[model samples]
Target: MAIIKLSAIERRRLSAFATCLVLSVFAWLFTALSSQQKYKVKLLAVFKNSPQKRAFHSLQPDSIYATVQGTGWKMLFSRMNGDDNKISIDLSALENKNYVVLSTQLKQINAKRDIERQVVSIDPDTLYFDLSNRLIKRVPVRLVTALNYQQQFAQSDAINIKPSYVTISGPADVLAKITYWQTDSLILNNLNESFNARVNLHPPAEGNLTVLPKSVTVKIPVDEFTEKTMQIPVKLIHNRNFYDVKIFPQKVKVTFTTSLKDYPDINEDDFEAVADLDQWLQGYRVLTVRLTHMPSYSKIVKIEPMNVDFIVKK
Candidate 1:
């Protein structure tokens, strides 16, 4: 490529041309923006001063459509400043009434914002609301968690949740069927050490429901694990007192995994297996062996035999 160097006079002339182009663009922008026009905008409207003693209330429409008349610059500036784009309505004076918000109220909202813009029109000139009696009840908070521990690591203590209960207030019909408030599902993966974390509560999917203390703290205690084995006697369950029943190989070896801190405390008594003789009475030759009980902090890993021979003795 060949380079053509410009003389000082030529460079000055080029600079002057670029400056004029910028000035012309600015002049046109100023003229266009100085003109006044009407603009339709959506504004978020918040409810305040809800009716007294009414604990549960819902607004029909939480937003509004208002037309503003102002210079393009003023409108542009106003849109950039979202703080001035909000409207508030007071409902404290409502007396168990369904309200129809009129355009007059919307005009007042525009004036309150003092946006230096004329209120032209408000679409959907009306809004509605339904207010009802409020009822409060205490409900249990259930923890939803998917916890996975690394191999040979286990939870040492019970999963702990602070503030295990939550108070909910809503319409009576909505609260009647709610037995408990459950937290949003939480997941902890590859957890090998004890830790604490905060989780949020689940909001009601619908209706005017309010849940207090929308979060809870979870503390989990994790520790190393060890393998343990025990022999538990199999109990025979039946109503045949007139006949002698026998389940050969009555004792079973139960292998389980438990935290090292808790392994020593576990015993055969902590586990239970049952071979229901009722199955034999029902005309089946064999009986199924099932683990009916086990230590809470332990997990059963293996059973010696899953089935037992059911023989009736004379």
Candidate 2:
């Protein structure tokens, strides 16, 4: 511990280490400076030609802004590489003007160095965004039958659909070709009473038609109908009691058409006829009976002779 001192060679080595450390720091600083630089660029957006009206009137100044971060070299390289960092503004947000300024700011490598001023100019600040609204109609759906379904079963029921209408929006050229929107074919067989289902609306293939509400609901009503043949016994009614009377027709044939739900409750008793023999006997050789009573829900399609003939026996 008495005395320990660095030799000449050790001093030289220590000085060299210090110098290298300083030079490394300087090199790092230069590299950083080269990576960070600020510059201005112009942005443009073009709209397709159309007769439709536009939403935005014009863009204002101070709308253009710069994205700050990289060195001038990197920014220039990015520009040459076709790297676009511009923000797109919606045309519908603008009024009658054609262009508007989006934003403007100084871009820099670091937040501290970002204070450098950069001038940015955007030509045609306002962009014309053409837009239009078109009305699309709904087409009636066709009824189809399943392959396995009984062919004899006819469509004797009514059909109902929910949300009968739908709206569509898109490019004017595309929208104009649309005539109507139709749903897929729906098959109903042996259906009774009420039915609820979901269906999709199909757009025409040729147009640029786009439906606002893509889907819709469909409803159909099913009912039962029946045809019944009934035999109504014929009876002769005479005005004078105990007068000898005779009926040529022993029974009357009656056919009724009604709903299946109520057909079972219907019978021949539902119909009747009264004959006035006194008035009919004077000039007529036979008196016929006409229908006087029938079920409200039932319809009489035909009756044999349309009446019952009766003769007076003296």
Candidate achieving the largest lDDT = 1
TM-score of 2: 0.31
Please give the lDDT score at residue 102 for candidate 1.
Answer: 51
All candidates' TM-scores?
0.70, 0.31
lDDT for each candidate structure: 0.78, 0.54
Instruction: Provide the lDDT at 88 for model 1.
Output: 68
Q: How close is candidate 1 to the true structure, as a TM-score?
A: 0.70
After aligning candidate 1 to the native by TM-score, how far in Å is the CA of 311 from where it should be?
A: 4.4
User: Which stretches in model 2 have alpha-carbon errors above 4 Å?
Assistant: 1-156, 169-180, 188-194, 223-225, 229-257, 262-314
Residue 194 of model 1 has an lDDT of 91
**Tens digits of per-residue lDDT for model 1, 47-129:** 66655456544555566777888888888888787645666666554556566455656565666765567667776666666
Tell how far residue 111 is off in model 2, in angstroms. Answer: 34
lDDT (Cα, tens digit) per residue for candidate 2, span 12-97: 99999999999999898778757656566553332222223331222233234444445755666657775554434433333444
Clashes of each: 0, 34
